[model samples]
Target chain A: MKARVTITLKPGVLDPQGKAIEHALDNLGFSGVEAARAGKVIELDLADGTSDADIDAMCRKLLANTVIENYRIERL
Target chain B: MKARVTITLKPGVLDPQGKAIEHALDNLGFSGVEAARAGKVIELDLADGTSDADIDAMCRKLLANTVIENYRIERL
Candidate 1:
């Protein structure tokens, strides 16, 4: 089984890297961009029968910093 | 308009970070994870009517390292 875990910073969190990207975009003449947020993607190739609960635990325990980020699980 | 660009390392490329994450997951007791590849997600808020072609250009020019990374664009 394959799954994707996306970890995004919650609203109001300070994202310095994101800010830097936004600035770079502006300098690169992509002024149409209003905002930019950078996040992490973890693509997992798992053994068959890995449950959704274990996937969720993976995000909570290590994949995401829960205090500042939220994660979504997508089974593929 | 909203779009997401996912940039992943091409297969066969050396990914030290991915290997590190796999090791960490094993130590954290997630033995079912056969492989883990880390990637980047860039979420963009754009002006209305931002064309798909522009998004593609963004990825090719800045959001991804075309030499080693492949990127997918998702319109949200």
Candidate 2:
């Protein structure tokens, strides 16, 4: 099975990395970019028949800091 | 308008961060993970009518390193 985990900061969380990118883009003369939020995407190759619950558990246990980030799982 | 840029290492490139994650997952007892690839996702809040060419330019010039990375842009 193949799964993709997208981890993003929760709303209202400060993202210094994202802010840095935004500023860099502006300095590069690509104007009109209101904001940018940086996040992580992890693609996993798993054994066939890996259950959704197991995937969720992986996200909660290690893939994400639940207090400040959110994760979405997609099985492919 | 909103846009997303997904930046991933080109196949065959070494990814130490991903390997570290794979090892950590194994140590944490989540088996069946054959491999893992780490990537970045940047969400952009842009002015309405931002052109696709402009977005592509952003990816090529700063958002991704074309020599060892691949980037996909999606408009939302």
Candidate 3:
């Protein structure tokens, strides 16, 4: 089974990297890009029996910073 | 309009960051995770007139590292 984890900054959290990316786009002449965010994706090939609870545990324990980020787990 | 770009390491490319993440998972005792990948997601809030070609240009010019990474753009 495959699982995909998407981690994004929590609402109201400061994202300097995102701001930097927005600026880079502006320099590249993409001034129409109003706002931008930079996040991370983690793909995992897991054992067949891996449960949703197990994946959730993995996110909370290591994959994401709960205080500043929110992660969604998708099983494929 | 919103656009999403997912940038992932090209196959056979060196991904030290991904490997490091895998190792970290191992240390956290997630032995069932067979293979893992680390990638980037860029979310953009763009002007309504932004065309697919313009978004593609952004990826080619600034958003993605074309040599080691492949990026997919989704408009929403």
Candidate 4:
């Protein structure tokens, strides 16, 4: 089985990396780009019969930093 | 309007970062984790009425490294 976990900063958290990328984009002539927030995508190949609850626990415990980020899970 | 762009490496591409992360996870006692792939998520706050086609073009032209990555866009 395969799953995708997307980790993104929570709203109101300062994202210096995203700001840097936005600045670079502006310098590269991509106008009208008001803001950019950067995040992480983690693809996992799991054993058969792995429960969604287990995956969610994994995200909460290790995959995402809940202090500043939220995670979404997609199973494929 | 806001759009989310997810950039992921094409299948079969080598992902050193993902591998490193996986190794770290294993060291931290995350068992049953078969493989890991790392990617980028970029959120964009665009002006109203930005066409999907234009956003796709932006992704292809700048947001993703098409030589090894693929991108998907979502509007919110």
- The DockQ of each candidate is 0.87, 0.89, 0.85, 0.68
Judged by lDDT, which candidate is best? Answer: 2
lDDT of 4 by residue, A37-70 (tens): 9999999998788789878977887789999999
Q: Top model by DockQ, which number?
A: 2
lDDT of each: 0.92, 0.94, 0.90, 0.88
lDDT of 2 at A60: 94
Weakest 10 consecutive residues, lDDT, candidate 4 chain B?
B24-33
What is the CA-based DockQ of model 1? 0.87
Per-residue CA lDDT of model 1 for A15-69, tens digit only, reads 9988988888889888889999999999999999999999999898888999999
Per-residue lDDT value at A23 in model 3:
93
Clash-forming residue pairs, model 1: none
Q: For model 2, state the Cα shift of residue A15 in Å.
A: 0.5
TM-score of chain B, per candidate? 0.95, 0.97, 0.94, 0.96
Q: Candidate 4: which pairs clash?
A: none
Query: What are the runs in model 3 whose C-alpha is more than 4 Å off?
Result: none
Sorted by lDDT (best first), the order is 2, 1, 3, 4
| lDDT value, candidate 4, whole model | 0.88
Model 3, position B36: C-alpha lDDT score: 86
Q: For model 3, how does the per-residue alpha-carbon lDDT over A1-76 read when each residue is reduced to its tens digit?
A: 9999999999889999989989998998887999999999988989899889989998999889999999999998
Candidate 2 chain A — worst ten consecutive residues by lDDT sum?
A: A49-58
TM-score of chain A of 2: 0.98
